[model samples]
Target: MKQITVGVDASSESRAAVRWAGAEATRRQQPLHLVHLWLTHGRTAQAIPHEEALLRAAQRLLQEAEADVRARFPGVRVTSELVTADSPDALVTTGGDPAHNDLLVLGSQGLGAVPGYLLGSVGLHTVAHAGCPVALVRGAEDPARLGDGPGPVAIGVSTRPGHEPVLEFAFSTAARYGTPLLAVHAASRHPALIGRDELEHHAAADHDAEQFHETLRPWRDRFPAVHVVEHLSHGSPARAVLDVAPGAGLLVVGRGHHAALGPRIGPVAHAAIHHALCPVVTVPHG
Candidate 1:
């Protein structure tokens, strides 16, 4: 059976992620796997005097998380695992594989002193290279707030060719939740249109309007029940999406893996992941 896997540590952020994953697994009727990585500080056998105690403490953390999830979400089948991974990359490599998990969920930041409190190194790495979609639980993560309420499931629709998976996920989520789907496309001011006449500006807006309608046609047919609202905003892509994100229940964006190394997420995705007021899901495409 497929599982909704969440990485856990001794942080409040990790506990929040567990709660979010538990609610999701219960809704989807999938098993919830709470995995904790035991990272050793040094190569030597006697790296620290309290090695045994640390290991025992980690085990207790996993057990407590599992029990809490099971109790809070009675329908969710919860399981815990203690995986020994030496590096952050190794943990992402193992847990992010789609063959092992359906959706990998992580906290915005884990238990560490790493910089960028919004997204630690592990969360950023996994989002960029994960085989499946990575969900970063953020903002008002209390278990009470995780519900199929009124707000729409929004996605930043890219005109770039390879965003089919992103659209499918967004539409399906909105359909499942019985909420509307908001598709936003930001039309950046073209360099060619610099100092152009009013007619040219109107022409650019018209062209973008046409493209937005054309792109959404097939998807509307595919998921007829999803009420989709298309918005063509005039500004930076990230700002456009962020504007509509406040009232949105969930925000979905595609990760543009166009480069060969480093900085996995594109600017828009990175901004949304860090700044969106709601939960942000990064669906890898291209």
Candidate 2:
């Protein structure tokens, strides 16, 4: 069966991620997998002692993480693994397989000396390339509190096509948690510019509103239990989503279509992962 997989390390952020993933697994009635990666390079015959000590340390960390998850979430079926790798690619590969994994959760750490920012290279790469949805959790968040309360789930709705996955994930999550769903779409023009031409802008906004409603119509019918609040705004999509994020418990954004060169994350997703107050999930589309 598909399981929820998370990357665990020594960082407090990683511990937070484990808690969040454990809660999600309990909610979904799915197994939880914890992965810890360690570098095994520079292990020469002469450095056998050092290598042995490093491996033992990695094993100990993995065991502790597994024990913590098991203690906190006894109902969840938990499994763990320790991989000798140079990077977090093992975790990415394991969680990116849609057939085997439902979602990949990773810890997001702030840049040194930077305030109110997160998402390092590992997060960016995983969010960009993972086939499954990815959730980035920060150290400061209280997973238990967020999981117990009914906070709005906000999603950035794009005017373009191929956002079905994003919508589906957002609606389903809201329905599952019995929380309100905020569908926000932002027009490219500024509010002032829109005001300059009242009639034209009103007509444009009306059209956009209708389009947004139509886009969500099917999802609404599919998830009638979810209470959706449509929001139409002007200016940056990233800013629009961020403005509502503080009140939301979870933020959902879409990873742009894979380019000919490679998969890439959109600006909105990048910003949300780095700065959103709540846990942010990036759903891959197209």
Candidate 3:
């Protein structure tokens, strides 16, 4: 069966990620896989100092993360593994592999030591290429804010087409927590040129509002229990999302997958992940 996977290390940030992932797995009735990755270069006649000790320590960190999750969620199946790779690229590659995981979770930052990573880089690389959704556990200091709460699930609804996955994920999350759903559409204000017609600009804004409301109709029918609020603003999408993030329990955004290679996280997703005050989940949709 597919599972929810989280990168683990010896840091409070990593532990918080595991805690968040544990509650998510329990909610979805899915297994949790705790993964720790280390780099190894082919050794010559001699060995690097404390290399063995570091490897052992990474293994212990994985074990402790697994135990912590198991203790908190006894009914959820938990597994841990320690893998070797060449560089930080391994985290992105391993996370994108569909055979091992369905969802990849990461802490906002690393332990500032060996085997620990600054997830800003990891999140940027992995979410752009991962076949599944990537969730970055960032935000308020209180862990409770992420798990169960009254805050709504805020989503950035793209004015363009092919954003069903983002909408569905946000609505389902809100329904799961029995909270409200906030759908926000951020549109740029029309430029005031030498002969620009103000009437046409207002007409365009109205059209956008209508289309955004229409898009939510099907999702509203599907998740009747979720109370969804529609919001349309004239500003940058990233800035608009950041403004509403403080009142949100989680922020859901889409990562477009169209490139044949390399990271595909667009400017909006990059901004949301880096700036949002709440935990952000990047859903991949083509």
Candidate 4:
């Protein structure tokens, strides 16, 4: 069975992300893979007597978390591991993790620090290279949808053909959520003529916007429920999506295909990954 992997750090945000991941696993009837990574560096001297005990404690903690996931979602299988590493990467990728996992959930920031990171650098790296879809959730948002209503899943698409996977993923997720998907295509900017009148400027901008919509027509048809909206913005691509994310429940963005390495979406995807208010699902361009 496909799994949903969540990187847990015992922090509020990590827990929040965990709760969200657990709900999703239940929703999809998939197993939950929870990982807790401990950082350690070898010392010249002998290790402390409590070091071994600490590992056991961590395992117990993970077991408790797994129990919570099972109680909330009884039919779903849950598994966990306690790993000690000197770095963050191994804990995240699961040291050559299995490919069966369909998604990886992570906190935007860690627990309890007053000045929490909105997107840690480690999280960013996984979003870029992880084989499966990655969801970056914020701890501030409620893990349980107690008061908030679920909204449409918003997915961003470039005119690029490689974004098909992302569009499909977003549409499927929207169907599962029973929510409409708003697929957005942001128009590329053309220079406003130096001395152009107001009407000319508006005309130029409108033309580009229409082109943007035209490019998205095929996508809208394939994902029938996606109420496609084309945004004609003069600024950065990431800026356009971030500005719209606050109104959405889920945001989906695409990474460029490795074959087209020159036009890779790492920077733009990275921007949306870090700045978007809603949980962001980064899909590697297939």
State which candidate has the highest lDDT. Answer: 2
User: Model 2, 22-80: lDDT tens per residue?
Assistant: 88898899999988866555457887768777778878988998998889889999999
- How well does candidate 3 score on lDDT at residue 197? 79
Flag clash pairs in model 2: none
Whichever of 1 and 4 has more TM-score, that candidate is 1
Put the candidates in TM-score order, highest first.
1, 2, 3, 4
Preferred candidate (lDDT higher): 1 or 2: 2
Instruction: List per-prediction Cα lDDT, in the order shown.
Output: 0.82, 0.84, 0.78, 0.72
Task: Write down the worst ten-residue block by lDDT for model 3.
Answer: 110-119
TM-score quality measure for candidate 3:
0.87
Task: Give Cα distance to truth, residue 286, candidate 1, Å.
Answer: 1.1
- Against the hidden reference, what TM-scores do the models get? 0.92, 0.91, 0.87, 0.82
Sort the predicted structures by lDDT, highest score first: 2, 1, 3, 4
After the best TM-score superposition of candidate 4, give how far the Cα of residue 1 lies from its true spot, in angstroms: 2.7
Off by over 4 Å in 1: 41-47, 109-116, 147-150
Residue range 96-196, candidate 1, lDDT tens digits: 78787778888775223654357877678778888788888863576677643536999999876889989988998898778999899998578899899
Where in model 4 is the C-alpha error above 4 Å? 41-48, 84-87, 95-98, 110-116, 146-149, 192-207, 257-265
Q: Tens digit of lDDT per residue, candidate 4, span 1-286?
A: 6688888776677777787888787767788889887768653345566778877777877887888787777776888877777766775467224477788888786334554346665666666667678888877777568124467788776766666678778877887777776756666554647587788777877877776677667756766765555455576777777776877889988877566553344756777765676788888766
Question: lDDT per residue, candidate 3, 1-286, as tens digits?
Answer: 8899898877677778898889888888899988887767565545677788888889889988888888888889998888788666787666657686778888775334543333555456667778777888752346664355546889999867878888888898899888899889886565653266778777878888898888899899999999989889777888778777889878999988665654477777877776675678898886
